[model samples]
Target chain A: MIKVLFFAKLSEQLGTRELLIESNNIKDTEQLFQHLLKYQADWSGVLNSQIWLKAVNQSMTTKNVVLNDGDEVAYFPPVTGG
Target chain B: MISVQKQDFNQQVEYNRLKSKTSIGAIVTFTGLVRDINQDQRVSDLTLEHYPGMTEKCLIDIVRQAKARWNIIESTVIHRIGALTLSEQIVFVGIASQHRGDAFAACEFIMDYLKTQAPFWKKETMESGETKWVDAREADQQALSKWNLENKC
Candidate 1:
Protein backbone atom coordinates (compact mmCIF):
# COMPACT_ATOMS: atom_id res chain seq x y z
CA MET A 1 0.00 0.00 0.00
CA ILE A 2 1.02 3.60 -0.62
CA LYS A 3 0.42 6.23 2.05
CA VAL A 4 -1.32 9.44 1.09
CA LEU A 5 -1.56 12.62 3.16
CA PHE A 6 -3.39 15.91 2.90
CA PHE A 7 -2.62 19.12 4.80
CA ALA A 8 -4.02 22.53 5.60
CA LYS A 9 -6.93 23.60 3.45
CA LEU A 10 -6.76 20.51 1.29
CA SER A 11 -7.39 18.32 4.32
CA GLU A 12 -10.35 20.49 5.27
CA GLN A 13 -11.88 20.29 1.80
CA LEU A 14 -11.31 16.55 1.36
CA GLY A 15 -12.25 15.75 4.99
CA THR A 16 -9.40 13.24 5.17
CA ARG A 17 -5.91 13.42 6.61
CA GLU A 18 -4.59 10.05 5.54
CA LEU A 19 -5.40 7.14 3.22
CA LEU A 20 -3.81 3.94 2.13
CA ILE A 21 -4.21 2.93 -1.48
CA GLU A 22 -3.58 -0.41 -3.12
CA SER A 23 -0.18 -0.31 -4.79
CA ASN A 24 -1.36 -1.87 -8.05
CA ASN A 25 -1.43 0.25 -11.21
CA ILE A 26 -0.38 3.49 -9.51
CA LYS A 27 3.05 4.45 -10.88
CA ASP A 28 3.50 8.12 -10.11
CA THR A 29 2.12 11.01 -8.12
CA GLU A 30 -0.18 12.01 -10.96
CA GLN A 31 -1.67 8.54 -11.14
CA LEU A 32 -2.15 8.44 -7.39
CA PHE A 33 -3.89 11.78 -7.51
CA GLN A 34 -6.17 10.52 -10.24
CA HIS A 35 -6.94 7.46 -8.16
CA LEU A 36 -7.90 9.66 -5.25
CA LEU A 37 -10.21 11.71 -7.48
CA LYS A 38 -12.47 8.70 -7.78
CA TYR A 39 -13.18 8.68 -4.06
CA GLN A 40 -14.34 12.26 -3.59
CA ALA A 41 -16.18 14.65 -5.90
CA ASP A 42 -14.50 17.75 -4.48
CA TRP A 43 -10.99 16.30 -4.74
CA SER A 44 -10.53 17.34 -8.35
CA GLY A 45 -11.61 20.90 -7.84
CA VAL A 46 -9.50 21.45 -4.76
CA LEU A 47 -6.41 19.75 -6.19
CA ASN A 48 -6.64 21.57 -9.47
CA SER A 49 -6.58 24.91 -7.79
CA GLN A 50 -3.64 27.12 -8.75
CA ILE A 51 -2.12 27.20 -5.28
CA TRP A 52 -1.94 23.43 -4.85
CA LEU A 53 1.48 21.89 -4.18
CA LYS A 54 2.73 18.36 -3.63
CA ALA A 55 5.45 16.34 -1.95
CA VAL A 56 6.58 12.73 -2.26
CA ASN A 57 8.37 11.05 0.62
CA GLN A 58 8.84 14.37 2.41
CA SER A 59 10.40 16.15 -0.55
CA MET A 60 8.79 18.58 -2.94
CA THR A 61 8.17 16.96 -6.32
CA THR A 62 6.29 17.38 -9.52
CA LYS A 63 3.35 15.19 -10.45
CA ASN A 64 5.45 13.00 -12.77
CA VAL A 65 7.61 11.64 -9.94
CA VAL A 66 7.60 7.82 -9.85
CA LEU A 67 6.09 6.20 -6.77
CA ASN A 68 6.80 2.95 -4.96
CA ASP A 69 5.10 0.93 -2.24
CA GLY A 70 5.14 2.47 1.26
CA ASP A 71 6.00 5.89 -0.11
CA GLU A 72 4.33 8.78 1.69
CA VAL A 73 2.87 11.49 -0.49
CA ALA A 74 1.29 14.77 0.58
CA TYR A 75 -0.84 17.38 -1.15
CA PHE A 76 -1.63 20.81 0.17
CA PRO A 77 -2.01 24.45 -0.63
CA PRO A 78 0.97 26.82 -0.91
CA VAL A 79 2.70 27.30 2.44
CA THR A 80 2.42 30.54 4.38
CA GLY A 81 4.76 30.41 7.36
CA GLY A 82 8.11 31.83 8.44
CA MET B 1 20.21 21.61 14.43
CA ILE B 2 16.53 22.04 13.66
CA SER B 3 13.51 21.77 15.94
CA VAL B 4 9.79 22.00 15.24
CA GLN B 5 7.78 22.10 18.41
CA LYS B 6 4.70 23.64 20.00
CA GLN B 7 6.65 25.08 22.95
CA ASP B 8 7.96 28.60 23.06
CA PHE B 9 11.75 28.99 22.73
CA ASN B 10 14.20 31.04 24.80
CA GLN B 11 16.33 33.12 22.45
CA GLN B 12 19.33 33.33 24.77
CA VAL B 13 19.37 29.60 25.29
CA GLU B 14 19.23 28.99 21.57
CA TYR B 15 21.96 31.58 20.98
CA ASN B 16 24.36 30.03 23.48
CA ARG B 17 23.78 26.62 21.93
CA LEU B 18 25.04 27.93 18.61
CA LYS B 19 28.12 29.66 19.96
CA SER B 20 31.20 28.22 18.32
CA LYS B 21 34.91 28.02 19.16
CA THR B 22 37.27 30.99 19.06
CA SER B 23 37.79 30.71 15.31
CA ILE B 24 34.12 31.46 14.79
CA GLY B 25 33.95 35.23 15.28
CA ALA B 26 30.48 36.17 14.10
CA ILE B 27 26.99 35.23 15.17
CA VAL B 28 23.75 36.29 13.52
CA THR B 29 20.29 35.59 14.80
CA PHE B 30 16.84 36.30 13.45
CA THR B 31 13.48 35.89 15.11
CA GLY B 32 10.04 35.96 13.51
CA LEU B 33 7.13 37.31 15.50
CA VAL B 34 3.40 36.83 15.11
CA ARG B 35 1.92 40.12 14.01
CA ASP B 36 -1.28 41.52 15.39
CA ILE B 37 -2.26 43.09 12.05
CA ASN B 38 -2.09 41.98 8.46
CA GLN B 39 -3.50 43.43 5.28
CA ASP B 40 -5.84 45.74 7.17
CA GLN B 41 -7.23 42.90 9.26
CA ARG B 42 -6.73 42.72 13.02
CA VAL B 43 -5.37 39.27 13.76
CA SER B 44 -5.94 37.92 17.25
CA ASP B 45 -4.18 34.62 16.98
CA LEU B 46 -2.71 32.09 14.54
CA THR B 47 -3.03 28.35 14.07
CA LEU B 48 0.01 26.67 12.56
CA GLU B 49 -0.14 23.32 10.82
CA HIS B 50 2.67 21.29 9.38
CA TYR B 51 3.17 17.97 7.62
CA PRO B 52 4.78 16.10 10.48
CA GLY B 53 7.55 14.05 8.94
CA MET B 54 7.77 16.23 5.89
CA THR B 55 8.28 19.39 7.89
CA GLU B 56 11.49 18.19 9.49
CA LYS B 57 12.85 16.79 6.24
CA CYS B 58 12.16 20.01 4.38
CA LEU B 59 13.85 22.10 7.08
CA ILE B 60 16.88 19.82 7.16
CA ASP B 61 17.19 19.97 3.40
CA ILE B 62 17.07 23.73 3.47
CA VAL B 63 19.82 23.85 6.11
CA ARG B 64 21.94 21.45 4.11
CA GLN B 65 21.61 23.64 1.07
CA ALA B 66 22.67 26.64 3.12
CA LYS B 67 25.77 24.89 4.38
CA ALA B 68 26.69 23.83 0.86
CA ARG B 69 26.66 27.43 -0.32
CA TRP B 70 28.34 29.15 2.61
CA ASN B 71 31.18 28.73 5.07
CA ILE B 72 28.98 28.50 8.09
CA ILE B 73 30.45 27.01 11.28
CA GLU B 74 27.31 26.42 13.29
CA SER B 75 23.58 26.98 12.93
CA THR B 76 20.32 26.26 14.73
CA VAL B 77 16.68 26.72 13.83
CA ILE B 78 13.56 26.47 15.96
CA HIS B 79 10.03 26.84 14.66
CA ARG B 80 6.81 26.86 16.69
CA ILE B 81 3.68 25.07 15.59
CA GLY B 82 0.03 24.99 16.77
CA ALA B 83 -1.80 27.97 18.24
CA LEU B 84 0.11 31.25 18.77
CA THR B 85 -1.11 34.60 19.99
CA LEU B 86 -0.13 38.06 18.82
CA SER B 87 3.49 39.16 19.34
CA GLU B 88 4.66 35.66 20.20
CA GLN B 89 7.95 34.45 18.82
CA ILE B 90 7.28 32.07 15.98
CA VAL B 91 10.67 31.17 14.51
CA PHE B 92 14.37 31.61 15.29
CA VAL B 93 17.47 31.14 13.13
CA GLY B 94 20.97 31.41 14.54
CA ILE B 95 24.22 31.11 12.63
CA ALA B 96 27.87 31.31 13.60
CA SER B 97 30.80 31.67 11.24
CA GLN B 98 34.38 32.92 10.99
CA HIS B 99 33.41 35.95 8.99
CA ARG B 100 30.54 38.39 9.16
CA GLY B 101 29.71 38.08 5.49
CA ASP B 102 29.16 34.32 5.45
CA ALA B 103 27.23 34.46 8.70
CA PHE B 104 24.88 37.15 7.45
CA ALA B 105 24.41 35.68 3.99
CA ALA B 106 23.80 32.14 5.18
CA CYS B 107 21.29 33.29 7.79
CA GLU B 108 19.26 35.14 5.17
CA PHE B 109 19.54 32.30 2.68
CA ILE B 110 18.12 29.78 5.11
CA MET B 111 15.21 32.07 5.95
CA ASP B 112 14.37 32.81 2.32
CA TYR B 113 14.35 29.16 1.34
CA LEU B 114 12.55 28.13 4.51
CA LYS B 115 9.73 30.53 3.82
CA THR B 116 8.82 28.79 0.58
CA GLN B 117 10.24 25.26 0.95
CA ALA B 118 8.97 24.31 4.41
CA PRO B 119 5.60 22.55 4.89
CA PHE B 120 4.20 24.78 7.66
CA TRP B 121 0.99 26.67 6.98
CA LYS B 122 -0.75 29.39 8.96
CA LYS B 123 -4.42 30.10 9.60
CA GLU B 124 -5.20 33.50 11.07
CA THR B 125 -8.03 34.28 13.45
CA MET B 126 -9.36 37.80 13.19
CA GLU B 127 -10.88 39.95 15.91
CA SER B 128 -14.31 39.47 14.42
CA GLY B 129 -14.18 35.71 15.24
CA GLU B 130 -13.58 34.74 11.63
CA THR B 131 -10.68 32.53 10.68
CA LYS B 132 -8.98 32.20 7.32
CA TRP B 133 -5.99 30.35 5.99
CA VAL B 134 -3.34 32.87 5.11
CA ASP B 135 -2.60 33.14 1.42
CA ALA B 136 0.89 32.53 0.12
CA ARG B 137 2.61 35.73 -0.82
CA GLU B 138 4.23 36.33 -4.18
CA ALA B 139 6.98 38.24 -2.36
CA ASP B 140 8.17 35.05 -0.70
CA GLN B 141 8.38 33.26 -4.05
CA GLN B 142 10.34 36.16 -5.48
CA ALA B 143 12.76 36.00 -2.56
CA LEU B 144 13.50 32.35 -3.36
CA SER B 145 13.97 33.09 -7.04
CA LYS B 146 16.93 35.36 -6.37
CA TRP B 147 18.86 32.52 -4.76
CA ASN B 148 18.07 30.13 -7.61
CA LEU B 149 19.24 32.61 -10.18
CA GLU B 150 22.44 33.42 -8.29
CA ASN B 151 23.40 29.75 -8.03
CA LYS B 152 22.76 28.93 -11.68
CA CYS B 153 25.92 30.65 -12.88
Candidate 2:
Protein backbone atom coordinates (compact mmCIF):
# COMPACT_ATOMS: atom_id res chain seq x y z
CA MET A 1 0.00 0.00 0.00
CA ILE A 2 1.04 3.59 -0.52
CA LYS A 3 0.62 6.32 2.05
CA VAL A 4 -1.20 9.44 0.96
CA LEU A 5 -1.36 12.64 2.99
CA PHE A 6 -3.13 15.99 2.69
CA PHE A 7 -2.34 19.16 4.53
CA ALA A 8 -3.77 22.61 5.29
CA LYS A 9 -6.67 23.71 3.17
CA LEU A 10 -6.62 20.55 1.10
CA SER A 11 -7.14 18.42 4.21
CA GLU A 12 -9.99 20.63 5.36
CA GLN A 13 -11.68 20.51 1.99
CA LEU A 14 -11.27 16.74 1.65
CA GLY A 15 -12.14 16.13 5.33
CA THR A 16 -9.29 13.63 5.54
CA ARG A 17 -5.63 13.93 6.39
CA GLU A 18 -4.29 10.48 5.58
CA LEU A 19 -5.23 7.45 3.54
CA LEU A 20 -3.62 4.11 2.73
CA ILE A 21 -4.19 2.92 -0.78
CA GLU A 22 -3.33 -0.45 -2.26
CA SER A 23 -0.87 0.17 -5.07
CA ASN A 24 -2.35 -2.49 -7.33
CA ASN A 25 -2.64 -1.05 -10.84
CA ILE A 26 -1.65 2.45 -9.78
CA LYS A 27 1.52 3.01 -11.80
CA ASP A 28 2.29 6.70 -11.17
CA THR A 29 1.04 9.77 -9.38
CA GLU A 30 -1.31 10.64 -12.22
CA GLN A 31 -2.85 7.19 -12.07
CA LEU A 32 -3.01 7.32 -8.30
CA PHE A 33 -4.86 10.61 -8.51
CA GLN A 34 -7.23 9.15 -11.07
CA HIS A 35 -7.92 6.19 -8.80
CA LEU A 36 -8.62 8.50 -5.91
CA LEU A 37 -11.05 10.53 -7.98
CA LYS A 38 -13.34 7.49 -8.03
CA TYR A 39 -12.96 6.92 -4.31
CA GLN A 40 -14.92 10.08 -3.58
CA ALA A 41 -16.84 12.39 -5.85
CA ASP A 42 -16.11 15.34 -3.58
CA TRP A 43 -12.38 14.76 -4.05
CA SER A 44 -12.63 15.45 -7.78
CA GLY A 45 -12.84 19.18 -7.21
CA VAL A 46 -9.97 19.17 -4.73
CA LEU A 47 -7.72 17.18 -7.02
CA ASN A 48 -8.58 19.35 -9.98
CA SER A 49 -7.52 22.53 -8.25
CA GLN A 50 -4.56 24.09 -10.02
CA ILE A 51 -3.01 25.44 -6.81
CA TRP A 52 -2.40 21.95 -5.48
CA LEU A 53 1.21 20.86 -5.14
CA LYS A 54 2.53 17.32 -4.80
CA ALA A 55 5.42 15.52 -3.20
CA VAL A 56 6.57 11.94 -3.20
CA ASN A 57 8.59 10.36 -0.42
CA GLN A 58 9.15 13.77 1.21
CA SER A 59 10.70 15.25 -1.93
CA MET A 60 8.97 17.61 -4.27
CA THR A 61 7.65 15.75 -7.32
CA THR A 62 5.49 16.12 -10.37
CA LYS A 63 2.45 14.02 -11.19
CA ASN A 64 4.43 12.06 -13.77
CA VAL A 65 6.56 10.24 -11.20
CA VAL A 66 5.99 6.52 -10.74
CA LEU A 67 4.33 5.25 -7.59
CA ASN A 68 5.43 2.17 -5.68
CA ASP A 69 4.27 0.26 -2.64
CA GLY A 70 5.36 1.83 0.64
CA ASP A 71 5.81 5.22 -1.02
CA GLU A 72 4.61 8.31 0.78
CA VAL A 73 2.65 10.93 -1.13
CA ALA A 74 1.61 14.40 0.00
CA TYR A 75 -0.73 16.99 -1.43
CA PHE A 76 -0.68 20.58 -0.28
CA PRO A 77 -1.04 24.14 -1.48
CA PRO A 78 1.91 26.39 -2.09
CA VAL A 79 3.59 27.08 1.26
CA THR A 80 3.11 30.45 3.01
CA GLY A 81 5.12 30.16 6.20
CA GLY A 82 8.64 31.43 6.80
CA MET B 1 20.50 23.12 14.43
CA ILE B 2 16.95 22.89 13.16
CA SER B 3 13.80 22.42 15.24
CA VAL B 4 10.05 22.51 14.63
CA GLN B 5 8.21 22.83 17.92
CA LYS B 6 5.23 24.49 19.58
CA GLN B 7 7.21 26.21 22.29
CA ASP B 8 8.53 29.72 21.85
CA PHE B 9 12.29 30.22 21.31
CA ASN B 10 14.71 32.70 22.83
CA GLN B 11 16.48 34.81 20.25
CA GLN B 12 19.24 35.83 22.64
CA VAL B 13 20.08 32.22 23.32
CA GLU B 14 20.26 31.44 19.61
CA TYR B 15 22.44 34.49 18.95
CA ASN B 16 24.80 33.57 21.77
CA ARG B 17 25.13 30.05 20.53
CA LEU B 18 25.93 31.20 17.00
CA LYS B 19 28.46 33.67 18.32
CA SER B 20 30.20 31.14 20.54
CA LYS B 21 33.00 30.83 18.02
CA THR B 22 35.33 33.81 18.33
CA SER B 23 36.46 33.34 14.79
CA ILE B 24 33.01 34.42 13.64
CA GLY B 25 32.97 38.18 13.22
CA ALA B 26 29.34 38.56 12.18
CA ILE B 27 26.08 37.03 13.30
CA VAL B 28 22.77 37.68 11.53
CA THR B 29 19.37 36.86 12.93
CA PHE B 30 15.87 37.11 11.47
CA THR B 31 12.69 36.75 13.51
CA GLY B 32 9.20 36.48 12.06
CA LEU B 33 6.28 37.49 14.22
CA VAL B 34 2.54 37.17 13.84
CA ARG B 35 0.83 40.44 13.07
CA ASP B 36 -2.44 41.84 14.35
CA ILE B 37 -3.51 42.74 10.82
CA ASN B 38 -3.11 41.17 7.41
CA GLN B 39 -4.57 42.23 4.07
CA ASP B 40 -6.56 44.86 6.00
CA GLN B 41 -8.28 42.20 8.10
CA ARG B 42 -8.00 42.45 11.84
CA VAL B 43 -6.33 39.27 13.03
CA SER B 44 -6.90 37.93 16.49
CA ASP B 45 -4.78 34.80 16.34
CA LEU B 46 -3.13 32.30 14.03
CA THR B 47 -2.80 28.53 13.92
CA LEU B 48 0.17 26.99 12.18
CA GLU B 49 0.29 23.43 10.86
CA HIS B 50 3.08 21.50 9.21
CA TYR B 51 4.01 18.09 7.85
CA PRO B 52 6.07 16.58 10.65
CA GLY B 53 8.85 14.52 9.11
CA MET B 54 9.06 16.55 5.91
CA THR B 55 9.24 19.87 7.76
CA GLU B 56 12.41 18.94 9.60
CA LYS B 57 13.96 17.36 6.54
CA CYS B 58 13.31 20.46 4.42
CA LEU B 59 14.72 22.72 7.11
CA ILE B 60 17.91 20.67 7.35
CA ASP B 61 18.24 20.71 3.58
CA ILE B 62 17.75 24.49 3.50
CA VAL B 63 20.40 25.00 6.13
CA ARG B 64 22.77 22.69 4.31
CA GLN B 65 22.26 24.61 1.11
CA ALA B 66 22.91 27.88 2.87
CA LYS B 67 26.14 26.54 4.33
CA ALA B 68 27.27 25.29 0.98
CA ARG B 69 26.63 28.67 -0.65
CA TRP B 70 28.23 30.78 2.02
CA ASN B 71 31.28 30.86 4.25
CA ILE B 72 29.48 30.36 7.50
CA ILE B 73 30.39 29.10 10.92
CA GLU B 74 27.04 27.82 12.13
CA SER B 75 23.32 28.36 11.91
CA THR B 76 20.11 27.64 13.78
CA VAL B 77 16.51 27.55 12.59
CA ILE B 78 13.50 27.37 14.90
CA HIS B 79 9.91 27.33 13.72
CA ARG B 80 6.89 27.40 16.00
CA ILE B 81 3.76 25.44 15.24
CA GLY B 82 0.21 25.30 16.69
CA ALA B 83 -1.93 28.14 17.99
CA LEU B 84 -0.46 31.57 18.52
CA THR B 85 -1.76 35.06 19.17
CA LEU B 86 -0.94 38.35 17.58
CA SER B 87 2.64 39.65 17.98
CA GLU B 88 3.88 36.19 18.95
CA GLN B 89 7.08 34.88 17.50
CA ILE B 90 6.64 32.42 14.65
CA VAL B 91 10.10 31.72 13.32
CA PHE B 92 13.77 32.42 13.95
CA VAL B 93 16.88 32.07 11.78
CA GLY B 94 20.43 32.75 12.87
CA ILE B 95 23.68 32.52 10.95
CA ALA B 96 27.28 33.22 11.92
CA SER B 97 30.11 33.88 9.53
CA GLN B 98 33.54 35.50 9.28
CA HIS B 99 32.05 38.49 7.43
CA ARG B 100 28.76 40.35 7.29
CA GLY B 101 28.15 39.85 3.58
CA ASP B 102 27.93 36.08 3.76
CA ALA B 103 25.91 36.25 6.95
CA PHE B 104 23.40 38.68 5.45
CA ALA B 105 23.00 36.89 2.13
CA ALA B 106 22.65 33.48 3.72
CA CYS B 107 20.14 34.76 6.24
CA GLU B 108 17.94 36.30 3.55
CA PHE B 109 18.37 33.33 1.26
CA ILE B 110 17.24 30.94 3.97
CA MET B 111 14.12 32.98 4.65
CA ASP B 112 13.27 33.35 0.96
CA TYR B 113 13.56 29.64 0.39
CA LEU B 114 11.77 28.76 3.59
CA LYS B 115 8.75 30.84 2.63
CA THR B 116 8.02 28.62 -0.35
CA GLN B 117 9.88 25.33 0.24
CA ALA B 118 8.84 24.45 3.81
CA PRO B 119 5.76 22.35 4.32
CA PHE B 120 3.95 24.78 6.58
CA TRP B 121 0.54 26.43 6.53
CA LYS B 122 -1.04 29.26 8.47
CA LYS B 123 -4.70 29.87 9.26
CA GLU B 124 -5.77 33.26 10.47
CA THR B 125 -8.53 34.01 12.98
CA MET B 126 -10.07 37.39 12.52
CA GLU B 127 -11.46 39.60 15.27
CA SER B 128 -14.99 38.65 14.29
CA GLY B 129 -14.21 34.98 14.98
CA GLU B 130 -14.08 34.20 11.26
CA THR B 131 -11.18 32.04 10.14
CA LYS B 132 -9.41 31.79 6.82
CA TRP B 133 -6.44 29.98 5.38
CA VAL B 134 -3.60 32.26 4.37
CA ASP B 135 -3.00 32.20 0.67
CA ALA B 136 0.43 31.84 -0.85
CA ARG B 137 1.65 35.10 -2.34
CA GLU B 138 3.13 35.56 -5.77
CA ALA B 139 5.66 37.90 -4.16
CA ASP B 140 7.06 35.05 -2.11
CA GLN B 141 7.64 32.94 -5.19
CA GLN B 142 9.18 35.92 -6.90
CA ALA B 143 11.55 36.37 -3.98
CA LEU B 144 12.67 32.75 -4.29
CA SER B 145 13.26 33.23 -8.00
CA LYS B 146 16.07 35.60 -7.18
CA TRP B 147 18.04 32.57 -6.05
CA ASN B 148 17.64 30.95 -9.49
CA LEU B 149 16.61 27.60 -8.02
CA GLU B 150 15.88 24.97 -10.63
CA ASN B 151 12.19 24.22 -10.24
CA LYS B 152 12.44 20.84 -8.60
CA CYS B 153 8.75 20.11 -8.29
Give the C-alpha miss distance for residue B63 in model 2, angstroms. 0.9
lDDT of 1 by residue, A1-82 (tens): 9999989988988899999998889998878878887777777776776567878887776548988999988888888879
How do the residues A1-82 of candidate 2 rate in per-residue lDDT, one tens digit apiece?
9999999999999999999999988989989888878789788887787668888999987558998899999999988887
DockQ of each: 0.60, 0.75
Compared with the true structure, what per-residue lDDT tens digits does model 2 show for residues B1-153?
899999999877888889888799999899999999999999999999999999999999898888888998989999999999988999999999999999999999999999999999999999999999999998998998999876432
Q: Per-residue lDDT of B93-131 in model 1, one digit per residue for the tens?
A: 999999999999998988888888789999999999999
Clashing pairs in 2: none
Q: Pick the candidate with the highest TM-score.
A: 2
Mark the 10 consecutive residues where model 2 chain B has the least summed lDDT: B144-153
Off by over 4 Å in 2: B151-153
